[model samples]
Target: MNEDRLQFWSLYATRFAEGFGFITLVTLLPSYINTLDPTGTTILGMTISAGLIVGFYTSGFTLAQTVAIVPLAWAGDRFDKRTVLLAVLAIGIGVYALFPLVDSSASLIAVRALQGVAVTGAGLMTLSLVGEIAAGSTRANHIGKANAASYAASIIGSISAGSLFELFGFGPIFAVIVCLMFVAWLGVFRYLKPDETRIHGFPFSDLALNRRLLTLSSFRFQYAFSVTLVRTWIPIFAGVAAAEGGLAYGGLAVALTVVAEKFTNMCCQPFTGRLSDSYGRAMFVFAGGAAYGFVALLVPFAPTIGAALALPTEIVLVVPSALAGIVLPAWIPLEVIPTQVSMFGEVSPAFLPLVALSGLLGIADSFREPASMALFADEGTDDGGVASSFGIRELVWRPGSVIAPLLGGWLMYEVSMASVFYVGGLFALTGVGTFLVILVWSHGRRALVEW
Candidate 1:
């Protein structure tokens, strides 16, 4: 391979490692909550609720990500992005290795916080490098491919994590992640070239003030809350107890629920990105965000949908003897060949509909993500601060990413679970409305098609 192709693939490997680690944790979160069983606690004589503690499980990670963004993004712009990426990957290896040590909620939060820093650094450097290397016209196409790599990793990670955790528990899962990170580190070290580009002073100030960026931020800011709340809750709704308003699925089943979205998003991004390259990116953003809100609103109605459609309550598969022997020799006895597997343990009528809705959510977001990313790359590349531009993008997402989990937890525990989806859907709808008015007012009607 040529040096450029090598570098691109290496960076895509980095994205894969990052996505694998992140999705593993996401896939296992319900298991963690079940294991930890968090309760009310007194801190400095003030009581904190269990619901808030549950919220902290996710918020702690995102809060750390919020904290790490400015410094990491600035370092990527001001110094060597390649070096920064390698360091982050090193940290990621350590973080994944530490997952097996999580004994309590507090410990998990601490580890997740460190993971946030690693994830932020990896994401910022890889994306900035991709944006900088690709030409403006094809930036979205390249970015779409990069993101597709991440989603592919997400699919594999969620499925493998769920399956492995079911078979061997958490230790082996992290061991696999650690080994993957090491391989990713080797790819970057051997194939990726050093980034010599440097920018002096802060570019965030300039990029933040860019009118186009500001308009995009208006939509992104609210959309962040919508995406974070809905995405994080999907696995939770699948795996948590039925009494908690979930379907109470097994690990593999829950993983499938999460995979539905990742799989569809992975499939659609590259094509949608190319279309956005030909058509208008802003139009894609508006359409995708609106579709996402509509699909999110339908999530809570999965049971009704399933019942009306007469969907099966459970799915059963009988494994062939040869396949069963190859797949489960270590976990199951050879005498148990031709095993019958219950994919969903006492699955609710909502399972199939929920998975379908999740896939629709992915289809919706695929249009929005690459298009929005291309816009940021366009602005940042013009301003000579691609990393800082993406930083501003991350910063715009911070408040929503940090706060939505807490809000979702409160809504999930205090109100109905459906209320969480309701509130999240409203945010997306309102956000698109605000984005449209601003886009038309600031850039005129033709802006959606032309820009």
Candidate 2:
């Protein structure tokens, strides 16, 4: 392979491992909640609820990422992004290795915070590097491919984590994760060249004030709330008990819910990125954001729609097994089909519609993500601090990613689970509206069509 191909593949491998490790944890979250926080944990003087604990656990990682972004991104720009990425990969290996030691909610949260830092660093550096190497016209397509790599990993991670945890336990699952990260580290050390460009000091203050960035931030800030809530809670809703405002699907079924979105997003992004390159990126962004919000709003009604449509009840198939002479009978409840054929269980009526909605979420994001990323890269390259520019993007996302989960958990525990999706959908709608008005007001009406 040539240098450019080697570079992209190395970065892609790193992204895959990052996604693999991250999604492994997400796939295992329901199990963690069931095992570690059956009664909830008391911090300071107050007794926290189970749902609130889930929020805190999930948010802990993002909080650490929020803290680590500035320093990591700054170091990447000022020194070598390749070095930063390597260090982050090493940290990820350590973090996953420690997952086996977690015995309580507190320990799990602590390890997750460390994992968050590793993830943020790897994500920031990889994205910055990809943007740097890609041609201006093809930047979005490259980013889309990179993101598709991550989503593909998410699909594998989700399915494998559930299956492995079911067959063995957390220890073996994380051991595999550690191995993956180590391999990613070795790949980076072997193939990715050191970044030579160096910017002197902090570039965030100026980048933060850039008019285009500011315009983008107006939408991103709100969109963050939408995505953080919807993405995190979808699996939660699928796996938790129906009594707890969930569908009570098995491990593999829950994995499917998570994978559905990722699968569609992975499949669509490359094509979408090329289209965004040809068309106006801003148009794709606005349309995608609006569509995402609309779909999210419909998420709460999935069960209702499924019931009204009166979908089929069950499916059965006979398939060959690993053993040469063995054949297996697989039965799947139509309402909630297990992704794995070995599991026998009935899920709620809402599963298929929810899965459909998840796919729509993927499609909507596929439209927004690459275009949005390319726009950021365009500005970052212009400013000569690509890492810092991406850092600001991460920073802008932090407030929402950090806070939305806590709020979603509270709503799930205190109110209805559907309410979380409703509110998440609202953020997307309002965010797009905010972006549209600002674009017309500041950049002229034709800017929406021509920018």
Candidate 3:
């Protein structure tokens, strides 16, 4: 391969391996927690293992890591991003390998939480590195490409989790992941070098969380609602409902829902994003929200598994839905900073910290996407009401991302998975309503625009 291709692949492979190792376990972590006590959740806590052990434990990762994202990114700007990258990868390796050390549900949860903590370095560094490495004209494409690797990683990990669980069990599987993390760690340590300059001490307080930035972050709330709800609840919802719905391979059916969502997200991203840019964010957001609502509604009523698989066609579109919902709305306030580097550069030193603290909003809420989205829109809020099409993305969705599965687990406990679908559908519709409100808010009168 040529030099550029080699570099891209190197980064992509590292990301993919980390993602594959992490997502596979995360999606399966709740199930693993439950497996420790098949009899019921009493052995673990007041609620299911997912809620008490997994959910609570996992947020430590999200909170610390997400809060660190902008700072980490700022660090990358000033220091050699590669140094930050190597250091974080090393930490991630240590954390992931320890998973096999725990025996009980409690210990397992703790280990998972610590794993989240270790991963933030890897997570933020990786994203910032992508920003540093790719040129402006090609940056979005690179980010999108890297994002696609996340989808592939989730598939590889989740599918492997199923196969590995049936064969060597969770212990062996985690061990394997640890080993893989080490390899990625080595690759990063040896081959990676920081080509980017370090950012000077950037303000973390007022600038990062300024009115313009905060306003931009608020738009993410609706997008987050759509992303988190479906990813977390859809599978359990479908998996549980499938048995009653007379489906074959209930497990497969459940997996299919998730896989379909991701696949739709990846495949539809280019088309949907371009369409959104062409048509405007509002139109796509409305359509995407409506689509999610429609799919979510279908899960409860799935008459058969074969028919059930169809929901991902629209309902489960992960990327498209996010692009539709987030891209236009979230970009509004990003323009306040003008340039990507300046965006962080202009933020007060405390601004980054507060922005990071703002992430706690999502972390505390089971790491739901809405919190992050809301924060993004809010942070991006500005004076000119200018709009731009770029921002940092937090994509270390591993066992560290406990909130979704934990919520999924509780959702499984309280009501039928189908009910969760209904709720998810309701959220989608609500998002659509939010989009409409934005348009009305922007304009004095109500008028509809077509994509």
TM-score (all chains, Cα) for each model = 0.96, 0.94, 0.66
User: Tens-digit lDDT track for model 3 on 340-399?
Assistant: 121111211222222222222222222122222222222322211101101243422222
Worst 10 residues of 3 by lDDT: 382-391
Off by over 4 Å in 2: 38-42, 313-315, 318-344
* Per-residue lDDT of model 1, residues 268-319, tens digit only: 9989988998887999999999999999999999989999989887798877
Q: Highest lDDT, which number?
A: 1
lDDT agreement of model 2 with the native:
0.89
| Candidates ranked, most accurate by lDDT first | 1, 2, 3
Question: lDDT per model, in order?
Answer: 0.92, 0.89, 0.48
Candidate order by TM-score, decreasing, is: 1, 2, 3
11: Cα error in model 3, Å? 2.1
